[model samples]
Target: MAAWGSTLWLLLHWQVDLKSVLIYLAVLLMMHLYTGLFITAHDAMHGVVAPGNKKLNTFIGTVTAGLFAYNYYGRLYPKHHQHHRHVATDQDPDYHGGNFFLWFLSFARQYITVWQILLMAGTYHLLQHWFPLENIILFWMLPAVLATFQLFYFGTYLPHRGEHEPGNRHRSGTQRRNHVWAFLSCYFFGYHYEHHDKPYLPWWKLYQEKDRLLKENERV
Candidate 1:
């Protein structure tokens, strides 16, 4: 569904021009909205959003990620699960990846160097030249930038740091801030500690369980 939608939009966009900037902006917004839908598919694949529906969730995730040639379900699911089990602990794969600078730099390198930008650009050009349209570059460039931003910033990089429970550091205000950013940026993925403590809970419900556990611990 996502791939088809993107292809359809690209085809339509090939015919648009500078006179269609408003239309281009509208398409850009739609693409951004679809990026959120992609995230939901990702959550479903993790079984953190739709428990007991693994097959359905996996199918949706595959389709959504497939649009960008990303196979998160096939490649990253087990790895992500491992991260959850060892989260904030030294054993966590996500934590050892890097600090802030390495995180952002690595992300930029992967995102831009990956086939995302190239594939999108090629698709647009192919459609435009084969079909012959006006102001096609406008349609192509913005969507590419938007897709790049979505994948790099929102999808891969930010979500990783959402929950910071360093095994070395006991806990701090910085960790709390990290959680806030995680929730806001990655749709509550910032509750990494809670998710780690209770992996079976759905993503939406993880925070509730976290709070419950926190209260219970405090009373002790």
Candidate 2:
């Protein structure tokens, strides 16, 4: 919440102009931060975030998720686990027969509803009086939208989309062999086979399993 609030402050107070190099740079930074918050909340959904302390973990999940545009963690907590259990099958909310755009839309449909959009719209109506619509779009709505796409592309589409490795139990895919490229793609979620295999690790710890993931893949 602190990260989001600080970003909001920047969007509202920082003078923004197309010509202002610094403001635009800050926008990019804010978008990245938004993505990070989303990822953190995702870790919480797996019960891997600050695990062993159920209240603290759920509290962190609820708060971080709410920061990501008031999402109800109660709704997401179950659905996300279902996604993992039913991945790549028609029952999976995140999969639409490997159709990229369709699955993306399906994924959105699973989480976003007409009422939620209306709520955000209504909230914007009230907030516009205080902050410019452009700033709200630039820092607030746009980043969340981009972060969703980034998440879908890296964490969903690339990993669980099509025909995965033939012997792989999870039917998941891994990204490029390069570590920097992997991390840059989606907080090391590019090592997705590792993730489905060990969803217990938080995003930051995903890299530590790289060597093991490769070794297992080679044997399979």
Give the candidate number with the greatest TM-score. 2
Clashes of each: 1, 0
In the range 1-220, model 2's lDDT, one tens digit per residue, is 6777876786776566978887767666776777777787889888888789888888888888777767788998888888789877867777778478887888888988676788778877897899888888778887777777887889888888667767788878887677787776688888988888898989888887887767876999
Best by lDDT: 2
Score each candidate by Cα lDDT: 0.54, 0.80
With a 3 Å backbone cut-off (N, CA, C), the pairs that clash in candidate 1 are 48-203
Candidate 1 residue lDDT tens string, 1-220: 6554675466554545457567666556545545555556557656755467777778777666655434345655665566556644565444436776676665455323455556666676687665545434444355535654554455345545545455623221111434455554544545545544555665566557657767897899
* TM-scores vs. true structure, each candidate: 0.56, 0.90
For model 1, the local distance difference test gives 0.54
